[model samples]
Target: MTGAMDKVGTTGGRKRRAGVVAALLCLVVAVLSSAILVSPGPAAAQQRPRTILDMLFGNGLDRGQPYRISPRYRITDPETPERRPARRTTRKAKPQNPAPKAAATAPDQTAAKPAVAAKKEDAKTILVVGDFLAASLANGLKDAYEDNPMVVVKAAANGSSGLVRQDHYDWSTQLAPLIEANDPAVLVMMIGSNDRQPFYGTDASLAVRSPEWNAEYQRRVDEIADIAAKQKVPLVWVGAPPFKFDRMSEDMVYFNDLYRQAAQRVSGEYVDVWEGFVDENDSFIYSGPSVDGQTVQLRNSDGITMTDAGNDKLAFFARKAIDRYVAADQTSEAPAPGARIDLPPIAGAATAVRSPPVSLDDPSLDGGEALLGGGSRAAGIDFEPSPRDKLVLIGRGTGHVDGRADDFAWNDKSSAVASDDKPVAFRGSIDLQKVRKEQGIKPPQEMPSILDAIMDDWSQDNSQAAGGAAQK
Candidate 1:
């Protein structure tokens, strides 16, 4: 019996030891699981790892029971269907009549305003003709009026051409057709550089400074002037500029004078480009004042053709006359955009308010009421001419006769007859007697003509040439 009790005690002790070992093993596992959960996991494992405790107690736990839910995490009672308001099924009453529909689409009757205003007036055409100089002038004028909507500049200049070269180009024949075709408001003509050469007259080939040459050249000039006059187109004739060569410059001066005379005869204005391209001493200059008053190179190395600045300056001179004659006529009190035109007020009509004129005198008139004087003379009374006012004839005979004492061929104020009763000398030093002797011609008291002056210069140049040749 004691031995049996000892065996039973041994078994009981073994069972207690096993329970204790199992309890120690569970505590060690719980500590290891808590440490693993508290510490950081492997970087590769983004998700929570399946723990041993979770696997053991996952199905056994009653986590959804009321006692298990914490006060902070507890869900409120679900909403009852009786507490919510029910939707209405019956529809509201419809209106008796619908609002009237807008009127049907119709075509617009009122005229729409123009997208862009039409031009008030056609652009005035300007026809330019001559040699290369005229071409340059045209270019400069075009640039000057580029922004102006009223001006149209046309270039019709032929290079290395002139009135003297009819075989090459006939201006008299060509100009009429050009005028008819273009119908230019203004005609600008410049020539005579190539005209320094000999010309062929109707009868024969004439010398450079001969009488026949002058007559023939004058006739050709008149023909061109007549063409412009027939069309009633205002002419602006530009004269030749002074050249670097003495002989050439002298010839140009003569040509300029002839051009001036011809222009005046035809009621045209002559533009003397000589002074503009000359120095203080009246000599050829390659550089001069431009249109903007800047000192710039004016001529090419050839000494005849013009630079851009030179061309602008040339056009500047011609532009003045163009403005006065061509553009001035178009200047009137035209109504501006949105401006009202003045008209007579009618009876029982609302009087239109208008700004008073800037000046009491009419701007269009020369002197307004001061000159009109109630449709009569303003300054003085009219003087009537009697039968004796007829022009008195200087010569007694109807045929060739000498002038009387009272007859002076020209006005007394002319410089042609000097204070000393002798003709005025030429502009610079070239003694008249010396010139006459060089040419084997007789000296005269009166001033020499353009032809005579040119002949004298040519003769002096020839003598110098002969002397230079003899010395060589």
Candidate 2:
């Protein structure tokens, strides 16, 4: 029974020893897992450990160093949705009316307001009369003098009226009334754009551009000028510019000629705007250099009407004549014709002495008889004519040099008749050897040819080989 008890105790001690070994292995495994979990990544692996305890614990030394965690590794709180930015919607509300918007955006308010403010009570009126083109000219003139309070542009134009359509709108009877009403300081007229039709009469109608038609047109134009002259108003007749149609432009040219004659006859000025609208070849153009020198469209798409820029250019040509009259009215008053003034008496007139007149043909007037440099020289000096003087006065030339391009003398023949004089020696050749010796130039050494150089190399190699064999 004692032996049995010893065996059982030995078995129990063995079981306890196995349990302790298993517990030690489990502790070692737990320590290894904790070290791996606390270790830094490869990037932080280069940092040194602060202490041996830190190395064992796998805590890398990051003291006093910046540590940034990547956003992918950052933990976000699920309860904080308000921290995110809200998205913006793209929907917009449409307006009910567009006209008010367009009216609010109307351009050139600064320019429009000043023009209205500049029209003073004492401003001088510039009366413009004609067809639709004259209406455009009026607008351009208004723009030209918008800032000048002293000048005012007024339009009395009839769009469908012309000299040919007297029955429709007669300018001869209507102009006198306009002049009296406006009492303008200057009268500007530009007609003939709509006058290319036949003139209807009581018995027979005159065809367009016919001799009878031209005579009647000139008569009507003359009558308009006469009315202005009678009213004592300054007239400025602006010529018609070229049109898109070739035939229409030709008619305008002829009309401009008549307008020029009539305006000149009345002692008035003519403004020719033809060259301004045409190109270098005198052909009609749609676009040209504007007043600011920038290229802009001058004519509308129809090619008959003018754009805003075109109207400004038309007024540019007529502005000078208009300004002259406006300036004349503003000029200071001259002295009255009957006014008289006392004049200062002439001084030192009675005792003044006069010198006798000299004749132009007298040589003594120039202080000598002979010409300059032709007077007598010193007694011992000799006077010889220079080569230039010989060539100029005697028509002779000096001798030419030999072998020159101008020397036309034959090589085998004498230049002058043979005389009993000795022949001249030729001295053109030179001795190169004597020149080289005097200059201390040495002769160059000759170099070996390709074949001779190869033979010399082979000979040297064979002699070396034979000496090596004897030494062996």
**Best prediction by lDDT:** 2
Q: Write one digit per residue (lDDT tens) for candidate 2, span 244-278.
A: 99999999999999999999999999999999999
> On a 0 to 100 scale, what is the lDDT of residue 373 in model 2?
44
Those runs of model 2 whose alpha carbons end farther than 4 Å from true positions after fitting are 1-117, 328-472
Report the CA-based lDDT of candidate 2 relative to the real structure: 0.78
TM-score of candidate 2 on Cα atoms, chains taken together: 0.48
RMSD of each: 30.0, 33.1
lDDT of 1: 0.73
User: For each candidate, what TM-score against the reference?
Assistant: 0.47, 0.48
Worst 10 residues of 1 by lDDT: 59-68
